[model samples]
Target: MTARPVIALDAMGGDSGPAAVIAGAELARERYPKLLFRFYGDETAIRAELARAPRVGAEAVVVHTATQVLGTDKPSQVIRRGRGTSMGLAIEAVKAGEAQALVSAGNTGALMSMAYLALRTMEGINRPALAALLPTLKNDSVVLDLGANVECDAENLIQFAVMGAAFARVVLGVERPRVALLNIGEEELKGTEELKEAAMLLRAVDLPMRFEGFVEGDKIGQGNVDVIVTDGFSGNIALKTAEGTGKLVTGLLAEAFKTSWLTRLGYLLSRGALRALRAHLDPNAHNGAVLLGLNGIVVKSHGGASVRGIANAIGVAHDLVVADVARKISDDLANFHAHRPAAVDLTSAK
Candidate 1:
């Protein structure tokens, strides 16, 4: 890790374009005073936003590019003809060692495709998983395979656990984080043969994490586990459901509070508590989702994220770079393979 880490930004990404991207960079700069930036986008638009944020402008170097990835662009299309685009150039900065990490609010599929193609997966990692921090009752829990690998085998799940545990150590400040597989029921035999085999292998290994048996959907918010492992199919659905439920609850509360004068008075009295709840439920607070197992770091911010949310996403990139999370993951994976149990054959298990 360097004293000052430079982040590559796809300045033309997201719904608000350079305005939100530059504003977010300014906020991130305030949080991390030693951070620097390389902004890639239309020079005129990027410079226009930078003018309003003198502090960030002083620390940023703009690279002009008229091309930008669209929300509707397919990953295959980007892979074939995206090198000149802002997103592609930003990713290239990381691969070329000019930037420590890349942050983009562009299309998720496109970003993943570009990153995987440019950076490739780390050695010993068969696939890269999308991991994010989810707010929980005790603290934030790391959930992986959010939308990267739809189908996974026992070996893939085990690898996700190792990578996810490394992420928790760096981001969540948890030592020997507890890990579990997401399944329909808590019973040992409830999930598929792949999951049960993965659990058995995890239990047998002497890894840096504590392998909790299993976790159900209802228990995700309980915060009993530090890392939750699942295939992208299940993990993505769980993430979307949680987001929808949060909005539903907040909307219902707003309507109830506006029903009558008595309720209005009650709302005024509970304003402080409501504000606290709002902060917890804010998606911006947990904006950055990393594509783990890549040689270089790549963080995906929500396209519709606000300035604060985008800043938080940048903050995630900064922290991961400073902590040297990629190296930690590499080291852990090496340790796992070196000490792998001779009796367990991943091929046979699969």
Candidate 2:
């Protein structure tokens, strides 16, 4: 923990290629002088970007990688091949203690696969969830399992809540973030037995978090919950829907302003407000989608992210290391699980 934080970035993993990734790395260093990076990708491509970037201390951000992880390849197959692939090699850097964490804008499946294989999960976490930050009226919300796992039961959901709490506390500075399960209704007995049982499970547990009961879908963008937990199926839908809605609104706003002189003039008047709204809703501000429950921090950025997106993600990795989130998670889980009930009957409803 005393060593300087070095982030392992898969330069070739995002859709933009190694150029954007390298630029992001430079931006990160410029923003944080103490920031160091280990870029993993094709040597030629990485070196080219470094040449064009602002002068950074040589050897501070080294290209310690070989091949690249492609979007087309299967995660399982790629993990097996172990082709000096960017994602694979990046994880290796962390596994070998050369880096504090790994960040990728490439394939989500590949990142999770390689991360689980290399770092494994924390002691008490049964499965890790991909937690993304979505903009809302209350600022940002942590939505988990954006499609990391297809199926999860009550216990798994509870675990995600705990991990999400620890993360929000560390990163967002929320001492006790409110946890919510996505449901059709807010009533305790609203959904299936799984929902009700999970609610009970969450309340029964002694987590270092605040469980505020279940949240509805409409509450997602309204900031009703700090941590929105759900099965992968539903969580993925909410994530994609919110993204689509944001784009749709922004596109419509642009079109409306271009149509007429009156609207255009009005738009000019409102441009400042629009920009502020855009910035608040901008996904880049929440660039880092953390793969929680992993032993090491793994930040997953949008595959088609711009240089700015990657840069923000690097800043996220830096923040995570500074907060010592992983160690805190390990410590919290050790205590929580130790006092958990042996077993709770969660039988299916008739």
Candidate 3:
């Protein structure tokens, strides 16, 4: 019999508290019937919520009490006082090998800091980066450094590209995923020195991925590349801009449909297409953001995620654990470094 993979959840994290957390776990339990869950939070509150969720079987869940970590808690403050906090305990579970992965809808900075401290960076990795799936016109693309390291060097960008490619292969099942560096223009001479240097290194490497050269901001949503690599500063800004645009378009569509009876009739007639559009554009559908290059799996759900969104975040963690993503990334890194030419080291570039 196969051992059921365990997931540690921060039950007291997030805006909706334990109730939504438990409800989301129920959704995950239904999707993965053999999964085991470790709930870390106020034991009494967790139990109360779980009791109301008959679908989240008691046999499948273990509850552990924690002092709770507030969303506003600074990363440094939390680290200094986070021993028994829900987020800390969940991460500890993963570090202790009691759980294969940990999921939290808490402060992003706090989660990243604690995960980095507890799990550390994987072997051969300098820093852990935040990576997530973004909906695109052609297909879903993976983007990295969503909000981790605001400033990065050539080596950092190269690492991000490799991690993003691996993520795309595992998550999107893309064979030899096309990797592209986000740049101001598609020209080789365009953009910052770090980007140009990173591109040069990628071009010289004989890795398992294809370096598709440079991709502009507008081409990101066009799905021209399977992976878009950029520094955290640029990646986060692009992500927020895309999210806002999606919302604006959605709002405009709703207003248009409500503006006239004919449009309402048209909406009714195009309900199927509209539903598909909504699903494709919904951020909740892509709720989980992963911290790659860590020794243990860590998934961050949106602080204000809905039940469906939380469930999806749990799903991402589960898949990463099952896929042995950390191991794959380590293996890929090892292969690349072993075969890379001696002249390609750009680690010290500013």
Candidate 4:
């Protein structure tokens, strides 16, 4: 029999705290009985919620004790002075091999900092990238360097592509995914010096992936590239813009139908279409953000995530552990580095 995938979740990290976490956990337990969960938070609050609405057959939700670690706490303080904090404990659980993965809707900075400090980086990766998954018209594409490392070098960008490619292959179940460097235009001469240089390096390297050349921002959701690579500064701005635009459109549609009777009638006529649109716009569908290049799997969910959002994030983390994504990523990169020339010395980049 296969061993259950164990995950350590920071229940106190999100805006919805123990209640949202509890609901999400219950949903996941019912949806996926094979998953084993360990929640870290205040024992009293969790037990109180449990008393009010107990989840039957919740043996998977083990309680890990921690005093407190708010979303506003500093990463330095959380890592050093604070020992029993929820985020701290979750990272340590992965480090100690007690958990296959760690999921948190806490401070993104703290999660990344703690994961880096705890599990460290894999070989050939100087700084790990936070790959926010975007559901495109076709397959999902990863936008990496999502505010993790603002300043990345040519070598860093190239290595990010390798990592992103491996990630898509395992988590996405693509045999050989298409990898592309995100630039201003599809032409190789369009992006900044770093992007152009990185594209050249990637062109020369013998990656396990198929290089789809350069891709622009407009090509993100066009199903042209499976993985979109860029620096944190650029990637973060693009991601926020896409998210903001999606929200604006959704809000506008809702207001348009609510204002007048004719519009309401039209909306009623297209209620099924609107429901499909709303389901597509739900952030829970794209809730998973993997902090790639770490020794273990660590997924970060949106801090403002709802119950369904947290549950979906848990589901993503469960897949990563079960697929041995961490090991596969490290091995794939290791092979690519051995074949590539001595350019950046990625063997020491970790």
Once superposed on the true structure, which residue ranges of model 4 sit more than 4 Å away at CA?
50-66, 258-260, 342-350
Ranking by lDDT: 1, 3, 2, 4
TM for every model, in the order presented, reads 0.96, 0.93, 0.94, 0.90
The worst-scoring run of ten residues by lDDT in candidate 1 lies at 341-350
lDDT of each: 0.93, 0.82, 0.87, 0.79
Q: Which stretches of candidate 1 lie over 4 Å from their true place?
A: 345-350
Provide C-alpha RMSD values for all models, in order.
2.1, 2.2, 2.7, 4.0
Off by over 4 Å in 2: 1-3, 54-57, 61-66, 341-350
Candidate 3 residue spans exceeding 4 A from truth: 61-63, 344-350
Candidate 4 residue-wise lDDT at 68: 59
Best by TM-score: 1
Q: How accurate is candidate 2 locally (lDDT)?
A: 0.82
lDDT of 3: 0.87
Index of the highest-lDDT prediction: 1
Local accuracy of candidate 4 as per-residue lDDT tens digits, 255-310: 99999999999999999998877777678887979998888889998888888888
lDDT of 4 at 81: 54
Clashes of each: 0, 0, 0, 1
Please give the lDDT score at residue 238 for candidate 1: 93
Residue 339 error, candidate 1, Å: 1.8
